[model samples]
Target chain A: MITDFTPWQSLGGGALIGLAAVLLMALHGRILGATGILGGVLRFADMDDWRLKAALLVGMAMGPLVLLALTGQTPAVEIPISTLAIVLGGVVVGVGVSYGGGCTSGHGVCGNARFSRRSLVATVTFMVTAFATVYLTRHVMGV
Target chain B: MKLVSALLIAVIFGIGIALSGMMNPAKVLNFFDLAQIGAGTWDPSLAFVMGGALAITIPGYWLVFRRAAPLQAPRFQLPDTKVIDRRLILGSATFGIGWGIAGFCPGGALPALGTGEPEAFLFVAALIGGLLLARALETRGLRSKPAI
Candidate 1:
């Protein structure tokens, strides 16, 4: 039972993400799907496309710096899970996003905003699985 | 112009995720732990993040679509498919399980790189490896054919 409920901060941050997604669509007419963007960055492709993705990735990498400048301290992030868990989870997420065609940003944020039925299904599917997984781990397995 | 704008927008995205505390895996995991809700321990911050994002993005998309084309691009690069296939469900389910195990998703995890955590880097590397494996399998025609 953690006592850290940050509704306002979460909302504000989500707005920023929304604004960024909107701005990107307005400027480039592209969806702000983080996994897709990263996939593009990793996969060698057209120079023009690569430059855009790389630029976006660089900007993402500047988050801590931005927070430091704004809040006067580097953001602190905690990874309570084991390294093995993190790695295995990462691999699962990676392939899932690949086969699923998008992640939270693409399907959850942008896709839902577009009212795409497919995105909605994807979101629901993932959310249900996430809930079940958490339930199993926390309650059943007690891991 | 496009590249510069992309960079700026992504920076905003990075800041938003950070400010929202999505960068913290523990907080995210807490939100996923529904059993804690009865005990008053579950964090509902992630829902607000989604709510806030949709609030802006929905209207933003509505407004943008009104324009014939974007400012810099000639046409919108939206996804073309409307088909909900086996791959989508399987992929999403696996991703969710992974997410439940580790609170980090791509959007959150990417910005986390800024925190200089070796774990973040490792997760990303593994994620890339996963993606590469999927791509290779697809290239080898290992993906099952869609059920029409």
Candidate 2:
């Protein structure tokens, strides 16, 4: 059985997200768009520009680590996928970030909040594709 | 520095994920897989994540927009068009398919991958493929219609 979902936890998460977005805007004068950050890193002209990208990526990686440290709960399941598949997944997401002009964080969070038509379209596209893929993979492919 | 700010934001975002239980991929997968399992209860963690995000963003946007000159750029760059055409529907469908299969969206996937989940990586790969295909099509479309 799946563990119970907690409202407090959800609210806490939302608050953190909102705060992060706000802080990014207030301090950096930028939206918290993950895709843009990654893209900038990949296409950066100056090596110094990569600093921000690295910082952002590192923070993302560290967030859960910190939580795990506090809670001491082990990850529930291990995906039995290969390393190649993992790399391929990253590449695919990178391409999507480029094609959509943003990732879920950019479009789904910042863009959607700002009422950006492009972001809305992109977010919708992302969600729909995700849903379909899940259905096919789990239901039809049974993988 | 911008790097510092980026790191700060990422950490805060991570904290939010931890608070909301989104860090648990199993829970996320269960939400998508609702079969064989009992009628799942609402995971309010998502709501908190959304609410918390909005709480900060709503006022934050107001402040940024109010500024005469944005720190990074000349003016706020907002999208010009709002048409819900074929691109919107098609892209959305594709994205949904991916999400449903993998039980992870890009935003969620990033954090999950950060946790060193192998499956998350695979999902990310497929996501990139879809993205690339979309981009190529978009570029082609742009070329076909110079006015756009």
Models 1 onward score TM values of 0.96, 0.74
For model 1 chain B, the run of ten residues with the poorest summed lDDT: B139-148
Model 1 lDDT tens row, A1-143? 36399999899999999999999999999999988899998767588888999999999989777888888986568887889989999999988998899899999999999999989999999999999998998889888
Candidate 2 lDDT tens digits, B57-120: 7677877778776565445544455666554444444444444434455566656666776676
Chain B structural similarity (TM-score) per candidate: 0.94, 0.73
- The reply for model 2, stretches above 4 Å from the true place, is A1-3, A46-49, A68-97, A128-143, B33-38, B41-48, B70-89, B121-148
* Predicted chain A of candidate 2: TM-score: 0.79
Query: For this target, which candidate reaches the highest lDDT against the unseen true structure?
Result: 1
